[model samples]
Target: MIVAKQKPIEEIIEEVKDSKKLLILGCNECVTVCEAGGKKEVAVLASALRMYFMNKGQEITIDEHTLERQCDHEYLEEIRGNIDQYDAVLSLACGVGVQFMAEKYFNIPILPGVDTCFMGATEERGVWSERCQGCGKCVLAKTGGICPVSRCAKRLFNGPCGGSTKGHCEINKDVVCGWQLIIDRLKELGKLDDYETLAPIKDWSTERAGGPRKVVREDLQA
Candidate 1:
């Protein structure tokens, strides 16, 4: 899942301070699951913005709306009729959603309300940890289902690095060495011998390093 966090209220307030009317748009996708930009968060932010303006003896029209998703055209079209009523939109979705919204509504200013973090997993209700880097390649098969590319502090293709000690990353005692985890997992699967084989030089062009990437399934296209 893509994880993100809410931007500071002060920054958000500053983004729309000059607008007479605004829309606090929320998304019910990954941001919602992470508690950054969901329906409840939209209400909280909208109410806070109102309260801030009210204290200044200024009145502003702030409307709250949560979309099923802000990244898809079909879902975004739902707001086409009413979007123009607001001077600007304060999107509480991830950066992707905010950018997509801007693309869909060229004349309106679409402001981001959250900082997109990373593709990760929910370790607990409020804790999220990075799990994938979307490198456009898979090495899990040889690495015992662990990704040294993302989980390693050094993004090591083949290593526990000399910095690792006692199976913990040298950068931080709390972090388990990515290679150590791979070794342990491989051992459990009786595939420890696989470690003798070195990983090939990764083709980084397949990753974001090559620039924005896209995949198309010809059959899926309508």
Candidate 2:
């Protein structure tokens, strides 16, 4: 899932303070799972902003709205008729959703309310860990299931580097060496021999290094 963190309220207040009308928009997707932006968060932020403006003797129109997804054009269209009522929209979605809304409504300002973090897995409640880099290449079949790109300190593909000691990374004792995890998994699968195989130099152009990437499915297109 794409993880995100809500920006500080002080910073958010500064962004919409000058606007007479504000819309605290939320997305019920990835940001909602991370507890960053959702229906409840929208209400909470709306209340806080309302109180702040009330105390400052500024009566501004602030509305709260949440869509099933801010990234979908169909969902975003739900607000088109009423969108003109607000001066700006404080989108509580991930970076993609913020930009998606902006692209759909070029005439209105779409302000981001959360800091997009990364594509990751929820380690547990209130705890998340990065697991994928979306490199546009899948190497898990060759290196067990664990990802070395995001987990390894050095992103070593073949084996654990000299910096790894007893399955821990040199960067920090608490950090587990990603290569160690891969080797252990290989051993369990009786595929330890694959460890001796040398991987070719990675072609990084398939990753974000290539620039913004897009995938279009011809089968799904109209």
User: Which 10-residue window of candidate 1 scores lowest in summed lDDT?
Assistant: 155-164
Against the hidden reference, what TM-scores do the models get?
A: 0.97, 0.96
All candidates' lDDT scores? 0.94, 0.92
* lDDT score, candidate 2, position 211: 98
In the predicted model 1, the residue pairs found to clash are none
- lDDT value for model 2: 0.92
Which one is best on TM-score?
1
Clashing pairs in 2: none
Q: Pick the lDDT winner.
A: 1
RMSD, each candidate, Å?
Answer: 1.0, 1.2
Report the CA-based lDDT of candidate 1 relative to the real structure.
Answer: 0.94
The TM-score between candidate 1 and the true structure equals: 0.97
